[model samples]
Target chain A: MKHRVAIISVGNTEYTSLRRETRSKAELAFAAIKEALDEVRISIEDIDACVFTSVDGFEGNVRPARVLESFGQAHNVPLIDVNTGGSAGGSGVKEAVHLISAGIYELVLVYGSPTFNEVVDNQQVLNTASPPIFEKPFGLGAAHMGSLYGARYMREYNLTARELAQVAAKNHKAAVSNPFAHIRAGYTTEEVLNSPMVAWPLHLYEICPVSSGAVAMLFASEEKAKELCDTPVWVEAMSSIADTFLSGYKVYKDFENLKILAQRIYKEVGIKKPREELDVVEIFNPFAPFELLAYEALGFCEEGQGVNLMKEGATEIDGDIPCNPSGGVLCTNSGISASVTRHAEVALQLMGKAEGRQVKSPERGLAHSWGGNDGQFHTVAILSR
Target chain B: MASTEFMNKEYNMHLDFSVSLGPAYTKWMKALGEKKILANKCSKCGRHFVPAKPFCEICFEPIDEWIETDGEGIVESFTIGYAKFRNLPDPPYVIGVIRVGPSAVSMVHWIAGFPYDKPEDIPDKIQIGMKVKPVWAEERKGDLLDIRYFEPA
Candidate 1:
């Protein structure tokens, strides 16, 4: 017997690489935490415990999770931190789900603060995941490694740069209406194709930028959800499965872990075909080629045919199955919390609070994220209203 | 509320140490320094693993045996970059994954001597299954840079 849980509120600060120098990191976090608590008409005192999701060394703090006391009113609370690489936000939400599912806490605050500064080199920060001896000597950094995957995927599936640009152009166009998006500009296919090549088959526009932001979500049990909000966005399922540590050790050309995770969640939620059953999808795609890999992995389309969805405009805002109506990670990714925002985006859509980028009354939605090296870690959650 | 809008302090924490190469990588690193490419053989599955792992992910067997290669491989995938990155060779270079010898697994490395005039023409120059050979550096340091890059055999 699974205990049902619902997200009462979801909020996040402005997503941007250039944050105000005057503001402190904790102040930025409080803005998001306060916004989420206010949506549910609950004070910080009402929340039982907190699950803080963040990276270990990135925040310039010894233990990044212990800084939750700075979240305005989160003090003396049973706080647990979860760091599953970039999927920390989704993992934190999952921990809260377990707490409610285990008949423990009724109200849990899920918070994440992913920060980076002007001094940090974005490529070097991510390249830390590479194995020191073999990979480092070759200069196979994060961006270079992603391009490697894109190159293989292109050669194996006969994918072209033009097709990949269409994915980027679509997301960038959608971000134009999203106030939270970091990079919001409608790029044409030719523009993206002609853009400087970061790696072969991938251009500068295809990669995600290093933005800074914080996110907070209020999770409550079914009884608590009924008392607080009229329309509760239920958490259907969350699946986190990781692969081998090295991308060099990956067996599959595409996202095999995501496929395995999607199958498990789909079986649990009784989803026959994800494309038809789900009304909306929010995928955490750091690169353009990843979006296509996700489409095939999540059963949105068959392998090598995700390009057809782009060509036919089937994933548009009003298409059969809308994908990333709030833009996506391609436009605004603040590192750690990027994956967590995937869930918040879906929850907002289901709660009819998606503001400008809301889809046409989507009842069911899916959120996905990939973290760590070589697309090794994948977390998926199915949400419904 | 306690606030700090005026104070801006910066600090750099620099720590350096050596990590044990363990049973597998220790052997592989030493072999690379000696101008040899090595792959760990999974005792149970009998498969070769490049960039050696302690055990097989699929079979869960400790890598007991090793295999040596003549530094020949085929291009599994290739990507050419035009921008210059820190501590790397000049611009307009090819980097790719190559399946060394008869191993099922591939290693990521630099692919030099790729037939490409402009960055735009790189997509058509290198294809999967292209033969390549390693080009070692003059001063070998028993690291990844021992073999400078892999070129058309």
Candidate 2:
């Protein structure tokens, strides 16, 4: 890295269901950008560059960055669009880090657009993400893509439905305190089990809602970060992994790609024991069972032992190595924004600015984002105060 | 606190795309019309692809060799759709990750041909690693759907 980069500020809007959203695309972008800039006490002119992350088809507009003027376009700032399916947010943030760390830009802004806002029927739109000829006609949607992992994982480990619900219940319980979270109903294990089954081995509550919201983050060089804020979360290490596009190419038994990614990142950061070394963590889990799958993939526990972590209340707010203190994407998924929130939430926790969902004085945290076709891409970052 | 009335606009995207099957997939799909399942084997890796890849992703070599299988696949994993959604089949459709004919990878398709007293019993009728055979469509069009679905064999 040419220069050290740190996260200075994060801006988030109140999340709601897609139909209930009142803010237009511009409004959503403006509100989040304004809040991020206001927190750092800097205007859009101060930022050197901007990065926008969202899927083209999901937004209905192929080039959403061109349509949305709130990303420093008025000030003539260069904007870079990043689209890696759901992992676009993480990739955008990584681009910002590169801009600063390369000594090319001092301040960079990454915006996580509400990707699902323009969809009439989310399932119809999501079905388009499948391979057009081969997989699309089979009626495989996002939930079905997520259910493949759960169905295979459960059979592999003899994991029961009640155990999966318990893992989901943890996130639902944590979301009650997160003001930015969309589904704050705080469903319990019984409630999750009782919810209507959308896909076998996955209840309706276990899946993420099609949320409407936006999030933005400010990344600055070490010198700029020192001048801008009292507390800044330093980017220790960041990297992402890619897999084959066809979902069938992957073995659904576990997050093998994520496991390989975590190993590479952990080795780079010299993290011997991820569960003991990291104080707080965030995982991209649109499906409830994914959190448990992620737990094993992230090396929080040994293989087939993620269930024990859930049973022991290990990932709760007060538990050792608390995960998804902001309720996670399992509760509120605004597509790309949800992936960006994983990093933003960790930064907030490290800065002691997490408000209702703060983990106690955390020094080191990990943020992960999973997206693309059946987990084609995964981004992992290690952040510290 | 503001009024709940939010003005909304709607736009529909009606777009069609024509994808080229290329040489590898062309041969594979053409075989399906004759009720034959062909898998392309990578020389370097010796791993077969069910859908017949143009090149092996791992070896990065062109898959020139082809082998025909009996279309018998093992259910690697599966999910039963229990709820209705737009552009998808009705409830109780089983989608399985079927590893056909010694292929290193699995392909997703519908799993059918089992007796179920009720729609809810669909999940119980299927199991991972269960052997299945292809059920060809009455009219073949050299498409992936040429095989209607896989059924318990």
Candidate 3:
């Protein structure tokens, strides 16, 4: 039998417009953690350990884990600082699940804060991710790297810029009901098209603004979850894969990694035909193109047919398989928090806690993460009621 | 941060240093002094690699053969960055993925034709298959910086 784990409670800080708030990183994280504890009616003494995730380079401070001792972690309990660039949030969730699966802790709290958005020239930091001696000289920032894949995809596959805009417009509309979302304002296709180009074929509005926020979730073993909360989001399957350092993997061409992960996740959860079975999905699309790519990659739709899924309204909030009901990274791209928040969104729907942005009967929700230059690292988790 | 207390000091020590080059990079530096771009060739696999590698990841064998690559290439893809990372040249520089010979692999380097003095004047009219050649430094001294960038032939 598989070791069972579940999310008992979820909490988050109101995603603050960067210009509206001026709080330190620790203060922001503390507020989210306190809210999560209060939601579950638990105290700091009851928490077993903490998994803190954030990209330190964005904070201009390396080793943020050491500085987190002030955030109410008990002296003896473990605190693991996790960082995996944009995927750090999902990585924290995977770490929490592993902690319970290994019988190391009965309950663990995972939290990721927003530190990437407040900094100036944020793209410069992303460009430095490659080896300084070799790759950095070429100015390989996220957008530049994304364009390489985007241009190739557009050229070879005949994907248009309008389809990319549709994703941004769709997510923006979804955020209208999410009071906690950073950007809830609706956008028109013309508005996205009229915006300045951050990178060619991608406009300013088409990309997410780095925002200030924090997300926290409580993870418990099956027994503790059953005894504590009325509704617990069970973790049916979770897996993570790292690609080659250079973007020379065969999976990119065949789009095989996501297929393999999705197949295994479905098998583990005893589901057939994900598009027909899974109730909701929150796939990371840091760039607008990746969501459509993921729709195909995750086998939600056939290859070269993701655009049709969007046009057919299958990915709408009330559609067959709602995609990104919480506005996703498009509305709020707070680096580390973006990926982590996807899990929290799924957990909320599973527990019937998502207030305005909740989906109906979301029995099985999929949260996925992609990071590294040219979408190198990936993680997928299947959460069910 | 250390210099904040002393307002009168003319100079302040900044400990912003990095160990950039690894072991295999020394050979590439030597080759650069002769105005040549060199990569290690896998004798067993017939593959050439830049910044020189000791072994081929695919063949799992030590690469004993070395090949001198032609400095002539074309700009396969390029980006004009507005901000600089740590220890790099000031912003608004033209960098490109240079495609050389039969190998599809492209090396990232600065583009010489770009006017670093007045970056705004530098045209964005560069094409994908434009012919270019490496611009070597006047005084070659066994370093990767020997070729500052590549420019149109």
lDDT of each: 0.79, 0.92, 0.74
Candidate 1 residue-wise lDDT, B15-92, digit = tens: 696877787877887888888998778888888877667888789777788889887988877667666665554667
- Identify the candidate with maximal lDDT: 2
Clashing residue pairs for model 1: none
RMSD in angstroms, candidate 3?
5.3
Q: TM-score: which candidate is best? A: 2
**Model 1 ranges with Cα > 4 A deviation:** A19-22, A71-74, A117-119, B1-9, B84-90, B113-124
In model 1, state the lDDT of residue A192: 77
What global local distance difference test value does model 1 have? 0.79
Error of 2 at B143 (Å): 0.7
User: How do all the candidates rank in terms of DockQ, highest first?
Assistant: 2, 1, 3
Write model 2 residue lDDT over A1-385, tens digit each, in one string.
6799999999999999988888899999999999999998999999999999998778898898898889788889999999999899899989998989999999999999999988877877888888888788999899999999999999999999999999889999999999999999999999999999999989999999999999999999999999999999999989999988887787887899899999999999899999999999999999988998899999999889999997888888998989999999999999899999999999999999998999988999999999898899999999999
Write the residue-wise lDDT of candidate 3 on A56-162 in tens digits: 66666677667765345555667888877777888889999999988888889998778574455667667667656667656666765655545445544667778
